[model samples]
Target: MTSLFQFTGSELEAIKLSVGVAIYSSLISLPIALLLGYWLARKQFPGKAIIESLIHLPLVMPPVTTGYILLLVLGTRGFIGQWLYSTFGIKLAFTFEAAIIASVVVSFPLIVRSIRTAIEMVDPGLEDASRILGVGRLKTFFQITVPLAAPGIISGTILAFARSLGEFGATITFAGNIAGETQTLPLAVFAYMQVPGREIETLRLVVISVLISFVAMALSELYIRKMKRS
Candidate 1:
């Protein structure tokens, strides 16, 4: 039983790849999410509705469909992909990079929505006051709006990270779950479940996934509470 419980080299590699993909995806998504969220919260433009709809599209779209779209747009034979590969030797499909992109796409909406809500929570009067005090708009935003929204940003970032950690459908569809490459824990769990004698391994991975999610949520809650107190 102990021997069976032991993770093989491939399993270890899968775990590492999973963490790498999730971390990369979350970090890359954070700044973009912040900027878009701020824009959505603070600005009202003619095509704002269209942009907001696009940002929220992933929340409603099927993960598999999103993955397929990514493949179509970023595959080796894709127009953009062909240019990337030819000009810069970059290709995205069926690779860890693809997995990161899939994770980012799926997780982005949560971060954006969270931060947008936070931004809206900030009082516009504060900005008015700052402007009257001769503070530039950008300075007011960096000092007042952003700090006030810190808790929301933190919660949103954690949510995105957690979403990335658990992403499966988009990742597998776009990256093909190749071991030691694109296979994250969710993909590994699926693969293990399909094997003849890996139920325990699958269960273990499931437990780990649950634990990771639980921790992320707990941290978010803690931050939220602290923010409220502050």
Candidate 2:
């Protein structure tokens, strides 16, 4: 069994890239998700449906389309990308940054949904009571609402992080799956499957992915249960 197997260095590089991208994606997305989620949960305004639809669109749209849109907006020749590269020498397309963006966009809906649900679960009466006491909007949100929503935020973030970890289509389309550069765990497994003599290595990666996902779910459940108990 060992004789037939040879894991290329690229495979390891892909795993590392995946982990880094996932971590970056989670960090970058968390704040945006929280803000959007809180807004959706707490506020009502004109064109809210449009904003909500845009936020959740990636969940239904093909990942390829999502990636293409990101490319169009963040490509070197694209507006934002060109300005960023020109002003800061920062290029996003086909790089780790692109991967993080793609992963975040794809996984954002999950985090938003989780957090929105959490925020909605908070009693509005409590917010009103805070206001009656002259608590400012910002202070009330940070001191009361966010704390009440912490359990939800944490679970949502965990879910988002895990989903980002396994993102494939958007990541590959935007980042180009370059080994040690943009390639991630899923890309590595796909690359291994494309060639001969790497089945065992591919299986190992599959097991690792499954294990990680299982652990994430388990931890989310534990956290939620603890929150409930408290």
Candidate 2: stretches off by over 4 Å: 1-9
- The best candidate by lDDT is 1
lDDT of 2 by residue, 77-118 (tens): 889988999999999999888899999999999899999999
TM-score of candidate 2 on Cα atoms, chains taken together? 0.92
How high is the lDDT of residue 220 in model 2? 84
RMSD of each: 1.5, 2.2
Over 1-230, each residue of candidate 1 has an lDDT whose tens digit, in order, gives 57555877887887788778878988998889888898899888899999889998998999999999888888888888888999999989998889999999999999999999999999999999999999998999899999999999999899898889989889988899898899999999999888898788887777778877898799889988988898
TM-score of each: 0.95, 0.92
Residue 120 error for model 1, in Å?
A: 0.5
State model 1's lDDT.
0.89
